[model samples]
Target: MAKYLILIYGDERRWDAETEPERAAKGAAHEAFRRAAGEGLLGGHELEPASTATTLRSATGTAPTPTDGPFLETKEALGGYYVVEAPDLDAVLALAARLPELASGHGGVEVRPIVEHG
Candidate 1:
């Protein structure tokens, strides 16, 4: 089986402003998606708001510099991720197409295969 990382990106502003009921509904939807993924879902989790994120930059001769917030400022930021096991890219794409964020125009999913090293 091939391992893939499904990165979920969305507008952190919209996510943070969501009401309690809206958050609950989203949670329920994720639960349903988890069930649908079944054995293909190896692991996944929601992330803290992007405001809490920190970025690091390194120079060849100096220590890494730490900065608050994401590396890139955009309408959407990475919100969460799922590690999945699938037979092929088609299956993974099908799964990603069902993501709630995409349906709502919040953001979209990025599917990338995991590289194995030994």
Candidate 2:
């Protein structure tokens, strides 16, 4: 099986402003996804807001520099991710389509196969 990473992106401001019920709904949706993924869900996590992020950059001939925040400033930020083992890209895409972020229309998911080193 090939391993794929499912990256979840969303607008932090909108997510923070969500009402309790709306937040709960999103949580439920995630729960549903978790159940559906089952054994296919190798690992996953919800990240803290982008504001809490720290980034590191390295120069061609210098030590790495540390910065406080995401690498890029964008309306949408990576909010979470999941690592799953699937037969192929098609299989992972099918599972990604069920992500709640797609339903919200505020963000989307990206699936990329993990490169294996033999």
Candidate 3:
């Protein structure tokens, strides 16, 4: 089996404006996804808002510099992620398609396999 990382990206401002009921519905969807993913769901988590992110940069010969926000300015930001074990890319995509992001049309999932070291 291979491990895949499913990165969730979204517009943070829209997410922030969501009402309590909308948020609850999203949570319920996640619960359903978790149940359906079953053993394939290795781990998952929702990240803190992008405003809380700390980015780091290192110059060729300088110590790493810490920054207060995401490294790039974009409409979409990484909002959360999940790591799962699957037999192939098809299986991973099938599971990723069930994530709430794609259903909401606000965001989508990027699926990539993990590189394993012998």
Best by TM-score: 2
Each candidate's TM vs. the true structure? 0.91, 0.95, 0.94
Q: Each model's RMSD to truth, in Å? A: 1.4, 0.9, 1.0
Question: In model 3, which runs have C-alpha deviations exceeding 4 angstroms?
Answer: none
lDDT of 2 by residue, 1-118 (tens): 9999999999998888889998899899888888888898999999999989999999899999999999988999999999999989998998889888998879889999999899
Ranking the candidates on lDDT from highest down gives 2, 3, 1
lDDT (tens digit, per residue) of candidate 3 on 1-118:
9999999999998889989998998898888878877898899899998889999999899999999989989898899998899999998898888877787778978999999999
Show the colliding residue pairs in model 3. none
- Each model's C-alpha lDDT? 0.88, 0.92, 0.89
TM-score computed on alpha carbons, candidate 2: 0.95
Arrange candidates by TM-score, descending.
2, 3, 1
Worst 10 residues of 2 by lDDT: 29-38
lDDT of 1 by residue, 24-104 (tens): 888887888788789989999889888899899998989999999889889988999999998999998988877788866
